[model samples]
Target: MKKALALVIAVLMVLSIVACASPASSNTASNSDSGTPANNAPAAATSSDSENITLHFTWWGGDARNAATYEAINAYMAKHPNITIIGEPVSWDSYYEKMLTQLSGGTAADIIQADYKWASDIVLQGMPFLNMKDGPIDYSAWAEMPAEYAGNKDYVMGLATGINVKALWYNKEFFEKFNLTPSDDWSWKTILEAGEAVNKADPNSHLLWANSDNLNAFMQSYILQLTGKHMIDTENYKITCSVEELTEYFNYVKALFDTGTLPPIEDLVVYEGLAYASQVPEWLNGQWGMCMTYASNTLQVLNDSTFEIGTMLYPVMEGATDTGISMMPTQLLCVNKASPYQKEALDFVEWFLKDEEAITISGLQRGIPANTEAAKLLEQNGVTNAIINESIAVAAKHAGSAEGPFDTNAELNAAALDYIYQVAYGVLTPEKAASQTIDAMNAILATLK
Candidate 1:
């Protein structure tokens, strides 16, 4: 695959050249509408005004993640004394819907651990968030900001703290029982063959682990592996795959569903990995063999299994001209463009990204740290978060240390996911499904453009 170096360099120049504005200029009277006072509302009438900086921060994750993040926030507050960081955590299911209301109503939090899928839509649409480039925030620290973002001044919304690498995480015991080795050199065809072997070994067990909800991202990884192109192109507001290619991908997935090698779509939807791990289900009970997922969720999958769970890059295609490349881009922290605490927010973000205290709390649960110094601290502490370590290593090797594909708006992702469900459930043939998806997506992309 050709390097996107020229694209990357051009983005960096644009971010560096945007105009700077005052914190007051950025904040509007609408701040009060979000249930928070403006940044300069006379510093409060209280005598302890020095200890009154309240920053509301929001993120989406499971309970373990919430606890770790709150601990980090508490530690920061304990030292700062003068600052109070409000923690607003939500589950992934409802997070984006609630946040879209907040962003639209001008009630967005001071700091948002943003999804990359939503960054382009939110920032470029002027959804009332602070532009990092228009302030003193340093783009130099973020190595993963894609060329499109780096080069565009108006869309500079957030700083990425971590990145995720897609891979096939499997149980060692299952492979041992089948007398099979999880081959690093295996292609997608080989993976299907392995799945067939596992299916034959236990008719009740599935060889591949998945829910109906995740088929699109799985397809994205698979498509990128085959074409070296993104599912959605931010620049053109388009999907690049031909109709035939998309039909082939969806048909393959549908075949897996129909063959009993993967769970039925209806049964899988209620069994998200975060909610189902540790129950010793067919997968953890040593029934299912391999699962497609990210490093961040490996702990959830392996938390209860007695078998040694290992992670490997997404299986490539045999004799293919291109290597399988996992999509890489974890969420990031973005300031409300209307935020009054622009400088202070930047200061807090800078510390959060670069501070040792923050790194100790994060431990790459959300993603691999983008901060070099903070990553080094995690390394030196000799923590055994092997999944994170492995994810970082794989991302560096195959993902080129650049920002991954992004959606114009976060909602469009839901639409894309819906298309996956429609196709998977046999509501439409792969050809018709792909055509419907492209048509639906192109309509949404038009709104973004």
Candidate 2:
């Protein structure tokens, strides 16, 4: 368990070093620039699928995802008798570290899955990836091309696999037992009240099972909604929020900790690095009624729960200018520019997104499909999850400003995350935490540009 946090911290340290290195455009050495080995490498010009070759694809998810992905991979391989595609599935906690190691060593999977923001960081680090538009993917299938790549016309970082929004998942049984409703009108205050009620009735349980990552994201939403601006204005390379606003955000966070809506700091510290509800046992054992996770993760987050689960919009703030919830891509799928088998890899990627069989098998495992036709097919087959679809509606109905690239800078995020942790633990007051966080973020932002 300790290794989890340590490994996570190590990745952040590595990123900080990467960020401080020579400007990416001038960096000589890059993980993506590593040359492919002759023996197993695919011929650069070969576009035919007739050749017998093995390819590897990597992604991170829970048991449901693994099963669906494995099934899909098998289906693909079975269709192309000569091509063997290996599925490299990793747990969420260990994914980035492993992905980074592979990328640094020039051993990254032919098809690389990355968070959209991380994909930007990868490019900024001088890592090369294929301009997916030059490949076999059908652009017309997409209803809305992820605008993330709009400004960087030369690069389509990855073919987006799905679209998701940040939201909370509630256990129906627990909510019913406590006479609570996870309704569309629910607000931050409503959740706190519900949590207090749950704890009063059963001290052994808490209102939610949220870790550092989840809580940090919640803080981001609050800041965005309250100020109508993000903490960092990446385009200008500046810290955008005032300390007064941050103090308000922290005070709300403190209220959550104080009301027992979330467990004590000690209880969640060990699970700090965990990114999903399915990762912790508290959600599974019914010790918590709700957990915040990305909409894409609904199926996986509820994998083993015996209780029926429901989805709700991320709680809103009254009279807010923005919804504070933005629809984000699920994962960016890019072909390794260094891959010997770029042609074949692109073929598989195209098939995964455009093929009905692939889309149906994958289902809502990755949330709502980005491909218009794929979404239609899933609807035709009734393979879509109702709650997951509802989550998408909620996100659209209350969409806010899109998060910018620098808005989620790895180093700056780590700094603020540390402060949030301190505030939760009670040793740091909200004012001090907000002041220190602003100073720390400004110092990091100053290094930008």
Candidate 3:
């Protein structure tokens, strides 16, 4: 009985060996037939069997942007039946906080829409976003600003969709009523003088509409123009200007308030904390003659006004070393490094940025196209508006260095606004405000390091 059991075990061992050896040979033959190496055979087979893919794309914008993006996505899906794009659209107000949370949790969408200011924190600082330089996206047709912004380093972290610059928008009727035309000279003295004349003509109408955020943008530009340096030294992660330089900026702002070039702080209190002056009744009703706004926002401002609107280049300071007009990317598209569908995400982004059909459908919702060919195609289709073209021309002629990501540092921005308001409301002198602002900004910069 023992001898029979041993013989049976030996036979069973031989059969087990043959079973393993046969599958190995069969897999090798299968790989050869499929034109894949043994090492990649499993992955190749899986890809062939399941070619369908879904990609998640997220962005923050208004209803118009959402609708346009959705149409483009649907069109792409129609052309490529194997791909499905899931869009997560939200308002600009809640976008950053939500996206940051999602990023930390590793749940961000496959494709992400990032702001130019978010690049330092989200891309260059070792964030897990894919390096787009290795991808198939084309950059040859893009303008200098967009191309540089998209690929600032060894890796390309973002693909710019549009280019924008800080610009001034004025209500034409208000200017005409005050016997003032938007100045072609575009100097600080000229704007202030114009504002004084407008306010004098109609005490009820203010020369400019500004919220805290608006003031911050103006201050950044002013400081850059005066000092020929960025608000923050991106290389060293420090405040770029001295306390004396900051004092000069604060004093200039105070002078605007004191000379009635800008509306009284009390008058603007209701809109103090807002980022945009769009909802202010004075702006919508045309009581505010002018506003510092983005080039992309000119159309919306015009639509909101009952009167015709005009655009102006951002004013340069006297003896200014720089233009102070910071041309920046309005929208940037990126792919998550950890996403399972990286290839699909890159494919979609390339198509969206370079395809003629996609550009035609996108129109100017995000501002002027960053791709030179797309811009030409958009113009050929008659989708280019005069205001947008003018804005682009002005930026091309006068814009200086683009603002660094640290220029929009939230903590520093808020502190600067607080000090500015304090100076406006007489709680702090310009000298004190400047001192405080420098200290506060330096503290914030230290934390970043």
Candidate 4:
């Protein structure tokens, strides 16, 4: 009987040891199922569809833009758990230089924020940004002008984020205090007369704040108005207008200076290299009543003012061939052809441009939304500013055909500015300045061909 009882005890002890060993094996299987660890679990888990892709999106803007973009990116990532986006925001001054270097070295971000003018230059030079025509991005909701930019095959650029046109920004209080209303006609003669009247009323104030950059833009519009030709004929690889035509354009600018409708060259010089209206003394003090600026920049200008601000039609040259208002894409988004995540990059762009939530977050900081539905959405939500709405409407009604890619040619613009400064300083007759400008521009254009 003792021998039999000892045998039972030994059997029970073995059973207990077996049960303990079972849990160790089961725990390993449980860890594997829960994606915790099984000693050799893959370094990173990935969805079958996404493979855990990551993309880099780069752009240049101020603090507001950076913050808004980051928020939008975060929202996108929340909805797309398998994807990650890295944001690279830089200042406008160093943006192009750094991008160019990265592009050449094959290390550029997968998604690029391209200047409209730079799109053609980069794509046509054999850089391979993905062609959206082959992609899933729905651009049917964009306005005609911005749509045109996206549809071009040689450029094959991404959707425009904003539509920008040069607008006349004015201080409403200054106009009212002088009993001045902007001319309904928006003709050069009428605008100058209005400016002269305002300057006469308040010796401390000037009719307009003119800087070389803005003045150059005005000159381009005036030339377009007169000649019905783009300043540079990219197709022909030459300047479209003659020296005589440019002289006439410069003479008008000179008249603006001589009559005190514009500030002296010396006064304007201090504001060079500054990008915002808020930074200019004349704008801050309300001494300058009006200026030429992009629709995209109107908010910043308005924010710094103590009085209500208004927008006017871009001035027209009397009996001119064009309205002198060019509506162009503010900037574009492009996908690198070499990027491993091309489809994902395009997906983000589609969401960024057309997504209602993203548009609300973006507002008009980048100018009017290029997506028609997005713009309407802002209006429906009562978030669209009245000034921005008016500017968009005015630009749409009066805008001319978009400028050619070469219109914003860096070398040509630099040469034009130099010649303009010479005319403003009385160092050269308008004729001489015009002649020199044409020659220099044609020389540069020839090399480009």
Candidate 5:
């Protein structure tokens, strides 16, 4: 009887174990079913079709400027649902260093906006350089550029972003006060004399403009005017000039500094680039008569100024070697070989070069639209911003003869500009400065090649 009881208990225990195992097996099956959807996966992302794509974009600008860019990019995203752009912006002070690191680290943006000064280095560093003819890069559409800028069948590093034409920015209030007229016929000689007259008339005020650094942009303009040459030429890989020409340029700068027409070096050091950016609050508020800058940027300083401003080309040097002004590529756009979405980037850039949307969004910050149709669109929009329109007009008139393929290594360009400043400050003689520049530039060029 006891053995029969034990056998019945064992059978009951086995039944209980079976019940537990059933539930556990069912739970495992349910979990596997839950993961089936994940294993099936979703579609890959791409530029076209239903695929999604993301592009990294970067630029340098102020807060207001960055906000405007954000708005533009947001609008672009709304139009193109599949494409997302990530913004990586920095202040101008940190822009170059940051970009260099990004590129060198092999994580550059898909489409980079480049300055002509840095294009050669970017290309030489093995970033899948593009020619104008790549896929849809339409250099022909860019009106501000010369026909020659068309991407060579070889390695074209960048596309024209905009044409930068330098011009004289005068305070309307001071011009009227001094009875000086803004004219195309005004020459460098006229500017010097007028500066002296304006300063003499108002001993407390400065008649001429000043920048913060030793390299005088003012000096470059006059030197270019006198010599019909540029300090750096990337196309032929030449630095054109003799020590004599540089010495004369430096002497001219010294005269301006000594004359009481322009600000002293010390004062200028405290007020660098304020003439363009109005960054120095005190100097901006102080009495300054005229400033020199690109036509596209003249309005930036005056937009909030209490005084009226006027724009015209810098005075041509009388009997100057070159009849035209020194113009440079203010900005450029290039496709990154490292970009995963090269085709999409090219298409977007093509649109930017040719589309109306790009013109409206850019607001011609870098310069006038290089595209012919884009320029017309800007005009049709009744934007009628004089600075941009004037820049466009100047570019249309004389971009071809503007000396440069200014593609010297960015470091060389910086070095050359630095030397120019040193000479202006009387820190070095023109001969020493010129020799140093040539040697440094040659070293840079050799490495680039």
Candidate 6:
């Protein structure tokens, strides 16, 4: 239950877990790759029916999510006075690094919350989460789930809380104030033009607010549109995109920085690993125009805000290699394989995912609920945000690929993001950063499995 603050604590955790054989194939690891559930889920029982126990649940979020979570957990506890649930909420920037420490030290929460990339990375490294078949998680409600957001059934990692899709979210007031007409069809080129106009009109306001994670996503989306491929071919264990392609990507990133399309690296670096763009003063004050990151984060970023927000599908050129938008699991509720209270942990997870009361209290905080019935109930209750639904709809329409755990390996992601800052700060030329990134990534990929 102790929090580890060290950033460098455990990329090395994989050294111990790398022995796990991947249940999915080298191709895009969809549910079809998950051949079968190793075993069926245990019959469900309410936590109220079980013995008195204390469980810890941890996740990264801002005030809105953190608040809703506690309310839901408290409601559950009220029903089952014997069970005490502790909520440990941390900022997104610090969440995973802290988890790396806890996971390595065998002190992770009983019920842990994981980003899809983190879940994918965990499954790719090893089945470190308690598989559904090994726990009392009810599977009946997740039947209509797509192969994309569904965890590897072959490995049977824990299920998604909801779906997450990235989009270009903007401040409607900011755009109008700048006399800009932003449209869903705008391309990267149009974005640059709009940014230039905003910069010219108000020297104090910038066009976009993107932390390192957002920058990485935008770069990937761009390259996917250009190359119809991801940064790394996890299936082949290679950086399949050529060095030249990587250079173009980096150059595009550089241009975004230099031309005021994105805030300068120096200004944005303070928020490098922070979860929300709202953490940036310029963004929080409405001095920035857009945030192109996870739409699931909309509510968190709108904390104490005064402006209207808008959504557009992430930009793609008219004729591109791929649309490159992905609809993925917002986060996974996984029980720690090492936790002694895993049975109890899965107990909370099932209630969180399936219980109508729990879903109502936590409606859309995580994204659209993965449970079909839960989704319908949320809609019926008018709990869905109009802005977030806009993003989910547009993103789903344009989704062009499935994400594999390999493509999002945590270590490989770190390597790529590290070079992104170097490119942004002019510490390395685009060509140099690109080649070094490929070489560095390939070296890490070689060691992953």
**Cα TM-score per model:** 0.79, 0.85, 0.85, 0.84, 0.77, 0.83
Instruction: Compose the digit string of candidate 6's lDDT tens values, residues 76-146.
Output: 89987888898989777668788867666555676788877765566655566666653356667653434
For each of the candidates, give the backbone clash count: 6, 0, 0, 0, 6, 0
By TM-score, the candidates rank as 2, 3, 4, 6, 1, 5
Better of 5 and 6 by TM-score: 6
Candidate 6, poorest ten consecutive residues by summed lDDT? 24-33
Among residues 3 or more apart in sequence or in different chains, the pairs in candidate 1 whose N, CA or C atoms overlap within 3 Å are 11-150, 11-151, 129-336, 129-337, 130-336, 130-337
Q: Which residues of candidate 4, in runs, are more than 4 Å off? A: 1-50, 146-153
Clashes of 5: 6
lDDT of 4 by residue, 1-449 (tens): 99999999999999999877663321122222223222111222223455677788999877788999999999999999888898999788768778877666566787889877665566556644666663457787776673335435434566788877777888888888878776436777876787777767766677788665677777788888889887878788888899899999889878888777887788888886677667788888888888877777766777767778888888887787677576677788877655655567777898899888889888877777878888788778876677766776787787676666666667778889998989989999999999999999899888888
Off by over 4 Å in 3: 1-50, 146-151, 273-276
Tens digit of lDDT per residue, candidate 1, span 63-168? 7778888988888888878877889897777677788777676567778877666655564554445555544555565555454432244555567667566677
Q: Model 4 shows how many backbone clashes?
A: 0
Report RMSD (Å) for each prediction in the order shown: 13.9, 9.8, 10.7, 13.9, 12.5, 9.9
lDDT of each: 0.65, 0.77, 0.75, 0.75, 0.61, 0.74
The residue-by-residue lDDT of candidate 5 on 1-449, one tens digit each, is 99999999999999999887662321122222222222112112234546787776776655655776677678778888888877767666757667777555555676777655554455455434344443345466555443323232355567766666766667777788888888767776677788788777877677666664224445455556667776655555665666677667766666676665676667766666453635545336657777666664544675656766777765567776654454456666776554555667676777656666766886656555666576677668765567656654654454325534343344665766777667658898767876776777767766654
Q: TM-score of model 4 relative to the true fold?
A: 0.84
Q: Write the per-residue lDDT of candidate 2 for residues 257-281, one digit (tens) a residue.
A: 8888888888878887777776678
How far out, in Å, is residue 377 in model 2? 0.8
lDDT of 2 at 17: 95
Ten consecutive residues with minimal summed lDDT in candidate 1? 38-47
Of candidates 5 and 2, the better by TM-score: 2
